[model samples]
Target: MATIGRFVVSVVGAGEGHNGRRTAAVARALAFISALIAFAIAGLMIFDAVRVVNEPIEPDQVDFRLVTGVMLVIMAAIVAPLGVLNLIGARLLGRRKPRGRTSVLTGSLLGAVVAFMVGADAPVVVWVSVIVLFIVTAVAAALPGTKRWVRGAPSPSESGELVLGGVG
Candidate 1:
């Protein structure tokens, strides 16, 4: 268990020298996970929409089926692109690009909106958890430390020594 925990920490970049980089790494992981979840949800939405459209329906229920299927398809359309954005953001963040933070922030905000809009029928706990996940991801990406890290600023210790011309 300890070994697995250590491995997870290492993979997440938690062992890095600076807090900024560590937080940025965490944001990247969260964004990546959120993107995967969004993709899965989008896939399920597409599948459900197809199933609804193909299922046998009584004449009076035709409108109901059509509306439900169309709604699901629309939701899927919204989610899949956001998922792609999140994936791109996560990849760029892993590379320490400044724009990665912007992308991730945008994706996180949009994702939270979509979750709130589409999760009306979901269990309260589940819906809230999804919202919380988005919020946390946004907060992590927006942190000062994360911003500095993504901008490629040297850590304080490194900066101070260089700026002061090093006492020897």
Candidate 2:
């Protein structure tokens, strides 16, 4: 009976072990992509800032401060939320057997679609953003959990038969 309990646990954990490595690697890769995007955005903003600041202040010329400030505000508004979401997702995937990848992918897609659809943003921006988030979320769900299965003795049932954790 004890051997049976241990075996059951081992079976459950090992079932996904092989797949877990590949999936986890994919998640890390997607996360790297997200970081890259964020870096690119930040870099562009910085370049734009320098260009505007060096330009002579003319009425027709764009206000560097205003432009930079607006850019910062927009970046903060959107990136902050994404950062939060990433944190939540990282935490969830931190678990041993993360939930369905479908939910994560569907959610990211729905969010990107609705946000960009209403915002009327560029096609590439919206699509890339959605796809990237989808990939990240999907990969994160395949991370592994604790692989140990504690052995336990079977308990005697009221019917006078050995029962395994309340199951026959």
Candidate 3:
């Protein structure tokens, strides 16, 4: 079941610090990439929203136009912040600080939700890109090293256990 979920880390062994560091690096890279995609999507959506807002009113279609504009605006609003947060979080993660986990997780989850909502309406290429980015972002977050970092555990390299009897 855990394996089916895609995010669960089941691999176990010694010397995971190096593996974790590599995994975190991958996640950071993916987060940065996804952030760029989110920004582009947000910009396009905002443009569409603005166009809808400025379009001439049609008595019969006013409700539909308004609803469409509102939803577009809402999606843009959500996407822009997610992009910004992911960018910042990824930067921090690269610096070996796990504090950005919350931001990364939030942005990824929200982006995934938005992608699902707009998939049918978006172009095939855009839809596929969004899905791929979402999966990559998720995988990064679920990596074993990332989990350990986020949980505030000291990796073996940083644990200073090599000194014998508490002496240098």
Candidate 4:
């Protein structure tokens, strides 16, 4: 019974190391670049908001700018932390840690929500690009090899398990 249980555990375990060195390298690069871009955009939005607020304008225009600035502030709040998390994740990947799935997921979901909320007001191309970027980043973080590396587990085929001692 114990042997059978052990076999079951091994068989049911998830596979690892599906990603080659090149793939992992690409993912790391993408994650890092995405993080930097996110942070930069957030900073720019903050600056724009501040500039809009500081500009002298009529009361009616002020109300519209205030609303836009507030929305930009909210977007920055969502994006800045995500950028930090992605940066940490990228560092971990560089160190062969690969432990950033949660951060990736969170960032992806938040980005999707933000895109959906603001996409209606933006051009179609901009909306599509944002959606695609979010998807690609999320997928890169959840790749099979990435998960295996993050969990520090060996691939199933490399575990040296065989059915019935190679006689089955």
Relative to the unseen true structure, what is the C-alpha lDDT of residue 136 in candidate 2, on a scale of 0 to 100?
A: 49
Total clashes, candidate 4? 0
CA lDDT of every candidate:
0.83, 0.45, 0.74, 0.66
For 5-58, candidate 1 gives per-residue lDDT tens digits of 888556444555655777888899999988998898899899999998888877
- Per-candidate TM equals 0.77, 0.41, 0.68, 0.66
- Candidate 2 segments exceeding 4 Å error: 1-19, 60-68, 73-168
Q: Score candidate 4 by lDDT.
A: 0.66
Kindly indicate the candidate among 1 and 3 with the higher lDDT.
1
For candidate 2, the TM-score is 0.41
lDDT of 1 at 157: 67
Angstrom error of the Cα, residue 115, model 2: value is 9.0
Question: Which regions in candidate 3 have their CA more than 4 angstroms from the true location?
Answer: 1-19, 56-64, 148-168
Clashing pairs in 3: none
Candidate 4 lands at a TM-score of 0.66
Clashes in each model (backbone N, CA, C under 3 Å)? 0, 1, 0, 0
Clashing residue pairs for model 4: none
The per-prediction CA RMSD against the true structure, in angstroms, equals 7.9, 12.5, 7.2, 12.7
Give the number of the best model, judged by TM-score. Answer: 1
* Of candidates 4 and 2, the better by lDDT: 4
